[model samples]
Target: MIRETYVLVERELKKWVGRRGTFFISLITPIAWLALFGKSLNFVNMFSSAGLQGANPVIVKQYVDQTLLRLFGTTNYFAYLATGMFVVFAFFQSVFGGVNIVFEKRLGSMNRLRMTPAPRSSIFLAKMAATLVRTFFYETILLVIAVALGFSVDWNAINFIEAGAAIALLAAGFISIFEAIGFAVDNQEIMFSIVNLINLPLMFASPALFPLQQMPWWLRDIARFNPLTYAVDIVRYNLLGVHSFNILEDWAILIAITAVFVTAGLLASLRVLENY
Candidate 1:
C-alpha cells in the first residue's frame, strides 16, 4: 500500500509542480486575505481615536494595550486574528483539495488508474497525502505573511509543531469527506456546489474569524461541534498564548471527530470503488 501510494503521490506532485502558473496563482488569494483582512480592522486605531487625546500619553497607551489584551488575549488584534486565519486558510484549502480528483476523473485519468493493479486504497490515500502536502506548504507561507504583518507568536519550535499537528488533523478530516465526495460524484459541478454550500457556514459558525465569546449563544453552540473551532483554539493556544477552549479537551474532541470523518469517508469511497 505504501509503495503504491508513493508512486501515485509522485504523479500528483509532478502535476502540481508542472503547473507553475496555477501554483503561483493559487497563492494570491491567501496572501491578499492575510494582508487586507489582517491590517484593515485596526482596533488600536479605533480605540485611540475614541477620545483619549487629552489624557496623559503614557496612561492612554497603557489603557489601550490593556483593553486590547483583555479582549483579544494579545495587545495586537492582528495577532489574535492571524492565529485564527491560519486555521481558516487551511480549512478552505482542504475543502477544495479533493477537486483534483473530480478533474482527474473527468479527464479519464482516474479510469486509467483504476485499470492498474494498484490497491484502491492507494488511490484514496495518495490524493489525501498530496492534499496534505499542499496544505502545509500554504500554511507555512501564511504564517510568514502573518508574522510580517505584526502577528506575534510564541516563536517556539514546540508551538509550531503543535499548530501544525492541529492543522494536519483538521485537514485530514475535511479532505477525507471531500475526497469521498469527489470519488462518488460523476460531475464536478455537484462536488463544487457541495463545497460552496458547506464552506462559509462552517467558517462563519466557528471562531475562525472571531472570538467564541463574542458569538451569539446559538452560534457558539454550533461552533462547539466545528473542527475548525478546536483547530483555531488549539492553534491560538500554541501560537498566541490565548484560546477559548481547554487544550486537552480540544484535542480529544478533534481526534474523535476526525476519526469518525476518516472512517466514514474511507468506507464510502471504497464502497463506491467496488461498483467499478
Candidate 2:
C-alpha cells in the first residue's frame, strides 16, 4: 500500500507541477482578494454603531483598541483579515480537490486503476497528500504576500510549525469530505454547483472574515459548529497570536471532525470502485 500510494502521489505531484500557469494563478488569487476585500472593507462603522455618538475621540480610540485586542489580539484589521484568508483558501482547495477524480473517471484513468490491485483508498489518499503539499506551498506564498502587504504575521518557529500542521489537518479533512461527495456524484456540474453554493455561506458564516461576537446570534450559533471556524481559530492563534477559543479544544474538535469525514470519504471511495 505504501509503495502504491507513493507511486500515485508522485504521479499526481508531477501532474500538478506541470501546470505552472495554474500554480501561478492560484498564488495570485489570495493576494488579490486581500488587496480588494481585506484592505478595502470598512469595519469602523460597525465598531462605532453602539450609539456612542458623543463619545470623545480618546475614549473611542481606547475602546476600539481594547476591543480589537480582546477579539483579534491585535489592532491591525488587515493582519487579522489576511490571516483569515488561509481558512478561505483551505475551503477553496477542498472544494476543488475532488474534481480531479471526476476528471480521472472521464479520462478512463479511474477505470484502469480500479482494475489494478492498488487499494482505492490509497488512490484518494494520494490525491489528498498531493493537495496537502499544495496547501503548504500556498500558505507559504500567501504568508510572503501578506507580509509584503504589511500584514503582521509574526510568529516563532514553533507556532509556524503548528500552523502548518493545523492547515494540513484542515486540508486533509476537507478534501476527504469533498472526495466523498465527488465519488458519489457523477455529474461534474452538480459538484461545481455545490462548491459555489457552499463557499460564500461557509466563508462568511465562520470567524474567518469577521469576529463571531460581531455576528448576529443566529449566525454565531451556526458558526459554533463550523469546522472552518476551528480551523481559522487554530491558524489565527498560531500565526497572528489571535484566539477566540481554547487552543486545545479547537484542535480536538478539528481532529474529531476530520476523523469522521475521513472515515466517510474512505467508505465513499470504496463504494465508487463498483461504478468503474
Candidate 3:
C-alpha cells in the first residue's frame, strides 16, 4: 500500500511541477496578501485607534506597544502573514486537487485506473497522498521565500513535527470536502465558481486577518462554526507560537473534522465508482 501510494504521489508531484502556470496562479494570491495586504493594513496601526480612544493616553500607548510586540514577536509583518498564507495555500491546493479526479474522468484516465486490480481504498488514498504532497511543496516554496525575506523559525524538532502534522491534517480535511463536491457536481464550470465564491469568504470569516475577539459579533459566530478556523488556529499555534483557543480542544476539533471529511469523501467516491 505504501509503495503504491508513493508511486502515485510521485507521478502527481511531477505533473504539478510540470504545470508551472498552475503553480504560479495558485501562489499569486497568497504572495499578494503577504507582500501587499500585510504591509498596507499594518495591523498595528489599524488597532491603534481603539487603544487611543480609551481613557488614558499613557495606557493607550502602552497597550498598543504591547499588542504590536506580541503580534509580531521578533519577526516582521511578512512572518505574521506567512501563517495565514500557509493555510490559504493548503485550502486551495486540497480543494483544487479534488477537481483533478473529475477532470481525469472526462479524459478517461480515471476509468482506466479504476479498471486496475488495486483496491478502491488504495486509489483514494493515493490521490489524497498526492494532494497532500503537492500542498507541502507549495508551502515549502512559500516558506523558502519568507525565510529569504527574513522570517525567523525556531529550528527545534518539536516545531518541525508539529508543523508537518498540522499541514497534513489540514490538507486531508480540505481535500475530502472537495472530493465530495467533485462527486456531487457534474459541471466543471459550476464547480469552479462555487469553489472560488466560497474560498475568500472562508478566509475573511475566520481569524486569519485578525483575532476572533476583534471580529464583529456575526463574523465571530461564523468563525466559531468554520472548520478552517480550527486549522488556521492550529497552524498559527505551531508555526508562529500564537494561541487563540485551548490548544488541546483545537487539535481535537481539527482531527475530528479530518476524520468526518475523509469518511464522507470515501463514501462519495465509492458511490461515484459504482455508478460509473
Measured against the true structure, the TM-scores of the candidates, in listed sequence, are: 0.94, 0.89, 0.85
Worst 10-residue stretch by lDDT in candidate 2?
41-50
* Per-residue alpha-carbon lDDT of candidate 2 for residues 181-271, written as tens digits (9 for 90 to 100): 7777778898888888888898899988789988999999999988889989988888887889999999999999889988888888778
Give Cα-based local distance difference scores for all models.
0.84, 0.82, 0.76
Candidate 2: where are CA atoms >4 Å away?
41-67
Q: In candidate 3, which residue ranges exceed 4 Å CA deviation?
A: 1-4, 42-64, 67-77
Q: Model 1 residue 90 lDDT?
A: 83
Q: In model 2, what lDDT does residue 130 have?
A: 86
RMSD value for candidate 3: 3.9
lDDT leader? 1
In the range 148-174, model 3's lDDT, one tens digit per residue, is: 656677777787677678778978977
Query: TM-score-based ranking, best first?
Result: 1, 2, 3
Q: How many residue pairs in model 3 have overlapping backbones?
A: 0
Residue 113 lDDT (model 2):
77
Give one digit per residue, the lDDT tens place, for model 1 in 1-276.
899999998988898888888766767776776688768876555666787656776777788789887777878777777788788888877866678888988899888999989998988888889888988887887788777887766679998898999999998989999988888888888988998899889988887677878888999899897889999999999988888778999999999989998888888888887785
Q: Mind sharing the TM-score for model 2? A: 0.89
